[model samples]
Target: MGSNSSKISDLPKNEYLKKLSGPESISENDPFWNQLFSFSFPAPTSSSELKLLEEATISVCKSLVENNPRTGNLAALTKVFLSRTRELRLSAECQNHIFIWQTHNALFIICCLLKVFIRELSEEELQLHFTYEEKSPGSYSSDSEDLLEELLCSLVQLITDTPLLDITYEIAVEAISAMVVFLSCQLFHKEVLRQSISHKYLMQGPCLPYTSKLVKTLLYNFIRQEKPPPPGTHVFPQQSDGGGLLYGLASGVARQVGSSFSW
Candidate 1:
């Protein structure tokens, strides 16, 4: 038995690290999981540092979901990440401009991980997970449903809550484009249409109003060179030659909404 224990201890470092980090070893009370909530990437001066931050973020998200499956642990982690992102956004506003890029990178990475997590579930599982509704007062609420709602709400807040002038134009466009991509996810699309949550959280939330302002801003800038297009004609401008980021994001949002209800 002692020799067997010695053999197990002699396992490769990578293998041991994998075991230690596996979801099975994770718990709601674990310090490692708590640390993930407070984890902040240092200002990345090089591509390598940025890459490390991205990898670490993804690994934490992946392990949480994989180990905990549909448990409250995953939901808690989702909330933590979203809260941290919001804090980072506020920090970026007051700090150096480099933090804006860092926040953008972090948001993009989180969205990518969310997309992967959604795609990993089967259609039936997706439906079951997302379609769940709260029943009795004392009944357990579905963690999957909470996770999905929190993610969508976080994206909405990220785009709509920030002051227009504080966020870079590139970051604004990227956030909008990311929102479009997230809404276009197969499971998310179906849920929004069937449940009408999109109308509640997006179409009527802040996107339409924000997009309208964006259109006006873009048109005003364009009018200096040439006459603006017809009032309604440019509602969702195409990204043709010389068209800008606002146009591209507007087109993406329009396409996403149109496609959601068509099916």
Candidate 2:
């Protein structure tokens, strides 16, 4: 332990240091997950410092959702990160970390939200909301209304903050689709087909019945409105993009949702 402490202390100030700080270790009842802010990213000058700070502000969002049980925190964290009021212009080095964090964590958050949303749908609600074909075979495990709202709120913020223009629509599509796949598998349960809805809905999020439609509409409308990409423009393979730091979260949610239902 002493050697580990010394190594951590001896480590140079850099974005790498920021990564070491980790998702906060929380007990079952911490009330709020304290924001982990480590000013370890090296900034040689005042300007560099500002940039690093901005990147940190953007990059630290995942810590809020690392083990979050409520969707509200995830939504709130997204708002905080994307707030123009708090926007930080990142240094090139810091930007790399920010990008890496986003690549890994961003989509993960989405997946988690989806799980919460799907889980939130009550057994009766799921049965009612979904058609016979859409219905799974069992009961949902629990009841939590706030989950979907929290998820959609976060998703909206994510879309608004990271515009399709900056990150590109391809990345967004792949991220959402990946999230869908993940939720369908991980959160599935035998009871979900017929019994009371489970706590999974407590996390999947708000959009739900609305989200599926909203997403489809948005994807369709965007495609209809935009000019076509030039032929032979070399559309990049989305898999290489590495869904960002948030991918695990979204993937985790997807796993949950997929486990529970068909779509």
**Local distance difference test values of all predictions, in order:** 0.44, 0.34
Clashes of each: 0, 73
Model 2 agreement with the true structure over 1-263: per-residue lDDT tens digits:
11122122233343332332233323313322122221222211223332333333333333322323322333333333333212322322244333423332334333423343344444444222222111133322244333333433444434333333322343344345433533343244544443223324423444344445545645554454443222221112223344442332233334333334433
Best by TM-score: 1
TM-score of each prediction: 0.46, 0.32
Task: Assess candidate 2 and give its TM-score to the true structure.
Answer: 0.32
Compose the digit string of candidate 1's lDDT tens values, residues 99-206: 554445445444434444444554344334333222332234544344554556565565556543334443454456456545555544345355444334545543
Worst 10 residues of 1 by lDDT: 1-10
Distance from true location, Cα of 88 in model 2, Å: 12
What residue runs in model 1 are displaced by over 4 Å at the alpha carbon? 1-21, 24-66, 70-73, 96-102, 120-147, 164-174, 186-193, 196-263
User: What is candidate 1's local distance difference test score?
Assistant: 0.44
